[model samples]
Target: STEALSLLEASGYDYTNIELGKEWFLLGGEESVTRVALSKEVESGATSLPKIFVGGQCIGGCSELASLIDNGELDALMKKAGATKKGEPKKNTGFLSFLNL
Candidate 1:
């Protein structure tokens, strides 16, 4: 669980509002949009752990996040997750750029 959270934080997630599951699995409220999206992924049988979702879509887990970051797609997802409004300029955080939210 410690490691799971560390990975989430390192990926720039704000872990405060999210509740951890019984075994420290990341969880959202029963009605959470992300939870629904992640559930779809699980139901579809994706063999990944630590699922990630944003803007009502399952973006995927740690490996997927790294790939998206490397490919520059993560910025858009961050924005969609309310990191910034459509007309807002991206915040300038030195090392952890996307964590500005």
Candidate 2:
């Protein structure tokens, strides 16, 4: 879970972290309600720990997150969610940069 959090932080996207306690396992509690809600949203139908959701959509676990980062899709998703990079904007060095693409 820590690895997942680290990856997300490194992505430079604004995010909120919610940690659930043992009480979350107890039925009928607020945490449990949240868990249930997450389960419904999760595609696997199992609420796994360290699940990452972007724009109210599940993006899977740490492995999935790492994959997105490797393939450069995370930036697109973050932009779609209205999150800009934390620091200076990325410079475009490709040929399309001349067109401000």
RMSD of each: 8.4, 10.3
Q: Which candidate has the top score in lDDT? A: 2
Residues 1-101 of candidate 2 have per-residue lDDT tens digits of 87887887787655667677665556543447766876787788766667777766777778888999999898887766665555645432110100000
Q: What does candidate 1's lDDT look like per residue over 1-101, in tens digits? A: 34444555565544332443443235445555544544565546453356555544555566666788679886777765665433446452221221110
Q: Rate the local accuracy (lDDT) of all candidates.
A: 0.49, 0.65
TM-score per candidate, in order? Answer: 0.46, 0.72
The deviation in Å at residue 100 for candidate 2 is 39
Task: For model 1, state the Cα shift of residue 17 in Å.
Answer: 6.9
Model 2 segments beyond 4 Å from truth? Answer: 25-31, 87-101
Q: Report the error of model 2 at residue 90, Å.
A: 17
Q: List the lowest-lDDT window of 10 residues for candidate 2.
A: 92-101
